[model samples]
Target: MHAATTVSLIPVLSDNYVFVLHGGGSGAAVVDPAVAEPVIAWLEERGLELEAILHTHHHNDHIGGTPGLLQRWPQAAVIASAADRERIPLQTQGVQGGDRLTLLGRHLRVVEVPGHTRHHIAYVLEPQAEEAAELFCGDTLFAGGCGRLFEGTPEQMLSSLQSLSALGTSTRVWCAHEYTEGNLRWAAEREPGNSAIAERLAAVQQQRREGQPTIPSSIGVELATNLFVRAQDAAALRQLRGHKDLWRG
Candidate 1:
C-alpha cells in the first residue's frame, strides 16, 4: 500500500549483510549493521538519516556497527530483545515477544525465535497492505537452512520455527546472508532424489553463478523446500542440526 517501500540489503564483510528499510526516502531503519563504513556511506550518499536500528540478535557480526552508526545519528534508537540485556547492553529500547512497535509507519510485531541464540527474534513487519507480511529473521532462519543452535535447545528452536511457520505463507523472509546456494547444496546431498531439494539447488546455483542474491525468500518457498522447516520435531531438528553442522559441502 505504501508504493512498494524499498528495503536495500547491503552486503558487508564476507558473509554478513546489513539491511536498510526505509519508506519514502529521507530516513531509514537499519537492521543488523555488521560494520559502520559501508552503512554510513550508504546513508550519507542517499542523504538519509538513520531513524532506528532493529537488531535480531547479539552476535558481534550483527551489532558491530552500532557504535559507529550512533556516532553519526546519536538520537537514533537501538532496538533489540530484552532477554539479552547484558549481551546487547547498548540497545536503547529492549523488547520481547508479542510486542509491537511502529517503524517507518508500519507495525512490526516481535516474534521470539530462539534457536541461533536464546534471545534471537524475528520482526514481522505488518506493512499497511492486504498481503500476508514480511519477516527480518537474521541468522535464525536462512533461505535454505537455519542457523545452528548456539544458546538454545532443539525443542526451543523447533518451537521457534513452528511459530515462524505459522505466519502467512506469502510473508517475505529477509534473512541476512547469501548462503542459499551452499545450504541447498548440503540439503540436496541429504535428500538426493527429492525434487524440492533438487529444484531449489538448481535455482540457487544459478543465482550464485550470476552473482545475484538469493534472498527475500517467501514463507511459502521455505515451507515447501527448507529442510529445517520440514523437521518433524525437536529430536529430528537436533539430529538435522548436527548433520548440518558437520556437513562439509
Candidate 2:
C-alpha cells in the first residue's frame, strides 16, 4: 500500500509556500520554509516535530526559515543542492541532481530544475505501491506561467519545464507561490479563444475566492494549460517571457 502523506501549505509573506509533509501520523519534512512562527505553531499543535527541511533554492524567502527552524529542532537535517552550498549555507545534506534520498520513509528523487535559478532543484517523491508521485517544484513551474529568467536562460527554463512535464501524469505539482489565479488570468488574455485556459481560470477564481488552494495541480492539467511548459523552444519561451513581463495584466 502507498505510504500515507499529509501535505500542508503554510502561507507566509505574500505568496510563498512552506510545505509540511507528514508521513502517516508523526515524522514530518518541510520544504522551502520562509517564516517559522506559524510553521512551528502549526506543527507543534499537531505533535509534529521538525525532522528535515528540503530547500529548492537559496532565495531568502525559501531558506530564511532554516535558521529559525533549526533553533527549534536542533537535529533536523537541512537538505539542498550541493552546487550552491555557499549560497544555501544552512543545509546539512548537500545533494546532487541524481540523488535518491529517503526522507521520513519515502524516496525522493532529486531533479535539478535550474531555470528560475542556476542551481534550483525539485524533489519528486515516489511512495511505494498504490501511492501517487508528487513534485515539490519551487518557482520554476507555476500554474500557467513560469518564473522570470532570473539567473538562467530561456533554453534552460524550457528544458527544465519539459523535464518536469515528463513525470507521471498523476504527479501532484506542488509549486511555490500563489500565482495561479493571476497566471490563469494572463493565460486567458494571451489566448482569449482558448477554452481550456478559460475553464481553468474560472475554476481557479472560485478556489481563490473560497481561500482554498488551487495547487497540487496534476501534470496532466499543466500539460494541457501551462503556456511556458508547452512553448516550442527556448526562443519561444523567451519571447513569451518578454511579452509577459510587458503584459500589465
Candidate 3:
C-alpha cells in the first residue's frame, strides 16, 4: 500500500489557505499559494523542501506567490492548465482535465472545474490504505458555498459543482478560502426553516469565535448542509448564487 499523504493548511492573506502536501519526507508540494513568506517559513520550520506548485486558476491570489516560491526552489515543477498558459506563464507542466500525475508517492487526478475562471481545475488524491481521499478544490467547491460566476455561466458553474459533489462521501474538501462561517450564515438565512443549515451555522460561528478553521469539510457535510450542492438543477443553482452574491450577512 502507498504511504498516506499528509496535508497541512497554511492560512495566508485575509482568508486564503495554501495547502502543503507530503508523505513523511523532505519533499513537499503546495496548492494555490496566495503568498510566499508564510508558506516558505512553514515549510522551512518543518525542514521540508518544495518539489511542486499547483495552480487552480489565473487569479492573482492563487498564482501570485508562485514566483516567490520558485525563487526558493527553482527546480520545483509548476503545474497549471495548458489552456491558461498565457495567463499563468510560470507553469512548467501545463495540464488538462483527465490528466494524472504522481507527487510525493501520491497519485493526483486533475478535475476541470471552470466557473471562478475559464480554466479552473481541482486535484483529487486517490485514497490509499486508511486515509480518506483529499480534494484540493481551490475555489470551485467550498464548505457551504461555491465560487462566483466570474468567467463562466450558471450552467457551467452548476455542472462544475455537481462533478465535485460526485466524489466519494468520505472525501475531505480542502477549499482555498476561509468562508465557511459566512457561507453557512447566509445559507441559514436563505432557508430559515432548515435545521441542518441552522445547526451548522451555529457550530461554525462557535468555531470562529474560538479562532479555529472550519475547513477540510467533508463531502458528506457539504452534501447535507451546502445549499449549492443541494440545488436541484441549474436554475435553482442560479437563483441561489444570485441570492448569495447579494447576501449581506
Instruction: Give lDDT tens digits, candidate 2, residues 67-164.
Output: 99999999999999999999999889999888999888778999999889999999998856676798999989987888888999999999899889
Q: In the order shown, what is each candidate's alpha-carbon RMSD? A: 1.3, 1.1, 0.9
After superposition of all CA atoms, the RMSD between model 3 and the true structure is 0.9
Cα error, candidate 1, residue 182 (Å): 1.2
Instruction: Give candidate 3 misplaced runs (Cα > 4 Å).
Output: none
lDDT of 1: 0.89
Candidate 3 residue pairs that clash: none
Off by over 4 Å in 2: 1-3
Model 1 over residues 1-249: C-alpha lDDT tens digits?
455557789988997889888778577999998899999999899999899999999999999999999999999999999989899988999999999998877789999998899899999988565655878999888998998899999998888888988997898889987788888888888889899889888888888788888878988999988889999988888998999899887
Ranking according to TM-score, highest score first:
3, 2, 1
Q: Residue 120 of candidate 1: its Cα lDDT? A: 97
Q: What lDDT would each prediction earn against the true structure?
A: 0.89, 0.90, 0.92
